[model samples]
Target chain A: MYDTNYHRASSVEEAVKLRSSQDEARYLSGGMTLIATMKQRLAAPSDLVDLRHVASMKGISVEGRKVRIGAGTTHAEVASSSALKSVCPAICHLAGMIGDPHVRHMGTIGGSVANNDPAADYPSAVLALNATVVTDRREIVADDYFQGMFDTALEEGELITAITFEAPEKAGYAKFPNPASRYALTGVFVAKGASGVRVAVTGAGSNGVFRATDIEIALSASWSSDFVASVAVDAGQLMEDMHATPEYRANLVKVMAKRAVAMAG
Target chain B: MAKVTLTVNGRTMSGECDDRTLLVHFIRDKLGLTGTHVGCDTTQCGACVVHMDGKSVKSCSILAVQAAGSSVTTIEGIASQGELHPVQAAFNQHHGLQCGFCTPGMVMTAVDMINRHGGQLDEVTVRHELEGNICRCTGYHNIVKAVLSANEEMHGASRQAAE
Candidate 1:
């Protein structure tokens, strides 16, 4: 890894101040992806503003149906959170399935969402659950937050403080993970709430996590596993790699959607 | 250079390293504790697993400065009074290792897994929890056995003490 300056920020204001002071500074949450990327020489920032110690950005609070998860909250914490599980177990189950125990220990929801890795688990949950991305500056709805794979609407020097969403009445997630890397080959999250039925697909989308409006429409009409399975996912917009063909990924979208619907039931 | 101070193996140690120096390198080169192995510099392999503030994490992916003021436990810290930890003893008794490259990380991960899951671990649960720790030798059959047996022994002992 290239030489860089590391500064630990104790508060959101300090974190933003420290980041702006350096020309090429990146906010370091869990460093699960950033550190690994830096080690590979793929990214080399001049400075890193560590946000793991920020007191206000590290917890899960649930009030009625609204759930707020601090950006600094680790995946492990999310997976074990009984409060979150009680309201929306699908997110907890999804959190538990990310990487392995060690990776989950250090990876954070904010970092994962901020990175917006196409294959990441949180983006699907964020999008499907209709969560709001609360930054240090303002709140952005999920639809506007995710721009594309590894891209977000977050401006330069902006920091995500928390994510808030109303717990869906029924929700479930299913992923077909790559055997070696454990990233989702294709993952689907299905949720039914006041906003109506929403289906989000991750890992397969060439443009990143996206709403499967067709599947959502089908589920909204029937709300059954059979209906989800019958919805054909178009392969044109899906990504194809060594692990799977676009057609296969398209099929996985339906299969995972079906499974998620079953799980929700 | 960055000055990082942290408690490792119950010893408060401080060292100066490059800001980018990984926690595994700090533990190995600076502190002279080489028990924590770095199998894959990439995060995929679990050969560099260690307990940071009592939770298992990939040491290779964490910078030394990021760990300052945190309590870390390496493979070298698990034994008590020259006696092997129950997990280590179980690994020895169950032939959980061959070539031994991944043992430190495997052992560390297993200790953490047992701590969290307790003695009621089943085969499937142990295998799932060992996902981060990769064992190229013995096909992980013996490693899984060692972890399960160690869980039983440790939990049984704790239960007896409570009784």
Candidate 2:
């Protein structure tokens, strides 16, 4: 069962103060994953600093070619935002397809990225988009942000404030969801950005979200579904689970990459 | 223990709860509102669905203190006086339940969805949106039907009020 002291923060400073002062404290956003983990006795913090009242930590805005999303913005908000739907439909689709409505309504993109479950969908998109995560302390690129499964570059008391992604010329995500948890068995996000073509895969990788450099190279040469499909993905490093084998997840990565590329077109 | 004050339905309720207490537990244990049932300790099940500040949220996934100063609408608060809420009435009328363990959550979820989605209920959409809420009984056919009927009734009432 969950156990913790509760504190609400009216601002980011208050939240940081609570985090710095409290023992074994964890910041609570939508509480979709955090609360569930607590209920299963997986995590037991001494205090929960609720961030709902942190006014600056909500919203989604598109300025020029980049879409900036506040850390505390819910998945529902992301999925339903008209601007995002128009400009970044793939991200919006990923948000809408995550788990179910209640989970989407309660889960925040920042929280999901921070938690970085190997099976999560958002990490792949963030990596594909090459997003920059702005925290209370500093901004970190996606490559620098995610270190390993359930790991990030965030410091002890830092709080993610927003994420900014350069709007891709075209992007799409395809995933084979685990039936039970609705998390991806293997998910791929393919995007053609100003930097170049990028292909990121989640759920299949043993170390969590990683770029499929082979597939990216193929797609960058010619942004086509056929090229993505022809790219060979080595499955030796994937994680094995009850839902699928390492080989199965690795195979799915290529298939999903092809589908995502086709959908992007 | 921490003191939390919030509006339930239209009435304000205040209580002190331990830091570990979930918002669902506070409603069921302290306020004696048992309409919100706990199907699973995990947040995977949407059995403890409630509305917080006009949005549907899983109460099991929130701390009581987190809900301070917010407006919460539990399943118990859906009924007024002795009359059943429209969604509840639709569930009953359409036999949307079997053992009834999942009805309260189903009804509340439907109400929230219909309110937000303009009451344009269809099978695929209802099934898609109701993924969080699980019903082992009735194959969810009657439950979906009930939600659709309630949507019409609710939207019709709104139209009449506008007239």
Candidate 3:
């Protein structure tokens, strides 16, 4: 909580300029995470360029197999969007499951993905559905976008305008959330498309959200709950905390994956 | 310092505060509306729940500057004139409060829930929707009954008005 300046950015380019020109500027979306961090003095930026006012970054559009969601669209909007629900109910369900109603009303998908928290819900969706992160600069595939927990391929001052992805044939998300905060303790998102199956695990990875290759391969071959349940996720690289052990998290990954498959079916 | 102007309980109020001032502080300290409590500033507790632009949000988690030009409603605004809102009346009838620390927030959250769900909420939906608002004293037994009764009251009132 330092003395900081707040600038309302009207457009994406203006937001970029506002952030890039400042000595230490942060882009503010929903401010669900950033504001909390700043309040805790964990982050002290000289300026915050508010992107919520930017009209271009607010919507959910679906066309054919393609679904493009504006980064600033709040989780509540996504959860309640009828157009998005018709095309991708799993996404709506995931959005609905994030935090509580108040948090969902304020938190945005763009903010969730940009922060790249290890336990965030959207990263698992983006990674599992093979979505693309569309920034003001360029498009980055979901696979290449996330690097590690709290890490992403986004360069400094870059603004994420929107995220685009082809709707999977079938997808479902399941998570064992931390009871107090409602953040994913261990979550699994499963998607089946023409390209086969993709499984992404979040909240358990020490390196952040990662693809469960074994689960993906098993589901690709069988596309059955039993197959996914039988697939073992390696606990070696998982994060161990007061909430769960590495081994327990690995088990959660498998169980969640199986549940996700069943739910998708 | 940041100068923010927001409509609180239908009053357009202006205030000056630090850029880091939370909306809860702005509403309570700056505007002098003490109904919104700050139980946990970490956003875990829903004690600071308020409606910003017709949507329920955690006032403690949002900055006053961020809420510039927005319309906010706190627990102080819940009662119209002197009459208690349907939810408030139901809370009283069902004995929904014990310590009353979380009442303001729970009432606000309940109003928002009824706003979205049309007051036809069942027990399961009420419990699920009440996930954000925690009541330590009531054991949630009376609180759930209050919400259901409030929903019924609201539904009957609306239905009667229509007729």
Candidate 4:
């Protein structure tokens, strides 16, 4: 690890200012990812702007059907929140299943969403929930937020403040996690909301998380496992890795979708 | 060097370290608390786990400066006065370790699991919760037993205190 300057930003405005002034600064949330990268000598920024203490960026709020979660909130906090459970238990369940208890305690949803790892759990949730990625600058809808694996639409100095979404009529998530790392092998999120039916697949996308539109259309007409089971997702569009082949991931997409719908029902 | 101040095991400790220094290194090299081990520095191994503001986290994955103003508890803090914490005592009684390399992290993680699960705990749940804390010695049979026993004893003591 190389020597760097550390700054604790008390406010979002101050955080932006700190980021702008530094020659090379990285925002620190929980340090679950960044610090590890630094220790591996993969990245060495000149400064670190700590955002863990900004009081305004922490909380879980559910008004009517809209759920707004602070960006700084930890996965463990989101997992255990009864307030969130009342409206969106799927999110709670999703957060609970991320990287075991220790990782959940240190990893933040904002960090996960920002990092946009192909195997991360939150991107599917955001895409499936039709959520808004609220940032210090402006709101980026889930559709426009994720650009690709390890990519997002967030501009330089843009900091995510919160994620807001409507509680779906029904939503369920299922993930086939890699045993060693606990990252998803192929995860599917299914939701039937007032807007329409949504199907977001993560951990199996060659281009990162993608919406399975065909699966959505089939489920929209009839919410049945038999129908979802019969749907053949294109294996070409899915990612192939050591844990799973493209055909295997394509199969997992279908299996996880059926399971998610069953759980949602 | 960056200035960081935080409470460690009830003592307000301050130190000057490189901004890249990990919290585990600060605890071990700077503060001279060698109990927290760093097995896999990439956060896969829970050997460096410690309570950051009352939540168990892999300390090696966290920078020392990130922990400024936060309270941290390590394995050395689990005992009260001269008496071992129930979890520690249970490990002794159950023969939960061999080389004892992963004991500190296992103990800290167990304390956290018991804290959250409360009285409603089972062996299966214990096994699931202990996934992050890997123990090569003893095959984890004794470690699992120790965690269950500790939960029982700790919960029993709390009940007696309440009564």
Which run of 10 residues does model 2 chain A get worst, by summed lDDT? A1-10
| Pairs with steric clashes in candidate 3 | none
Better of 2 and 4 by lDDT: 4
lDDT of 4 by residue, A201-247 (tens): 99999988989999999999899887897787999978877898999
Weakest ten-residue segment in model 3 chain A by summed lDDT: A227-236
Off by over 4 Å in 4: none
Q: Model 1, range B1-163, lDDT digits (tens) per residue?
A: 8889999999999999999999999999999999999898898779999999999999999999999999999999999999999999999999999999999999999999999885779999999988888878789999999999999899988999999
lDDT string for model 2 (A1-265, tens) is 6667888898999999999997699998888888888888999988888887788989999987879999999999998999997888999988988988777777898888888888899999999999999999899999899999999999897899889999999999999988888899999999998979888999999999999999999998898888877877888889997889988887899889989988898
lDDT against the true structure, per candidate, is 0.94, 0.88, 0.92, 0.91
Give i-RMS (Å) per prediction. 0.7, 1.5, 1.1, 1.2
Instruction: Report the candidate with higher DockQ, 1 versus 2.
Output: 1
Task: Tell me the lDDT of candidate 3.
Answer: 0.92
For every model shown, the clashing-pair count is: 0, 0, 0, 0
Of the candidates numbered 3 and 4, which has the greater lDDT value? 3
lDDT of 1 by residue, A18-39 (tens): 9999889999999999999999
**lDDT: the better of candidates 1 and 3:** 1
Top model number, TM-score: 1
Scored on chain A only, each candidate's TM-score is 0.99, 0.98, 0.99, 0.98
At residue B83, candidate 1 shows an lDDT of: 100
Q: Give the TM-score of candidate 4.
A: 0.98
Q: Which window of 10 residues has the lowest lDDT sum in candidate 4 chain A?
A: A31-40
**Residue ranges of candidate 1 with Cα displaced over 4 Å:** none
Q: Candidate 4: give the clashing pairs.
A: none
Q: DockQ values for all predictions? A: 0.92, 0.73, 0.84, 0.82
Docking class of 1: high
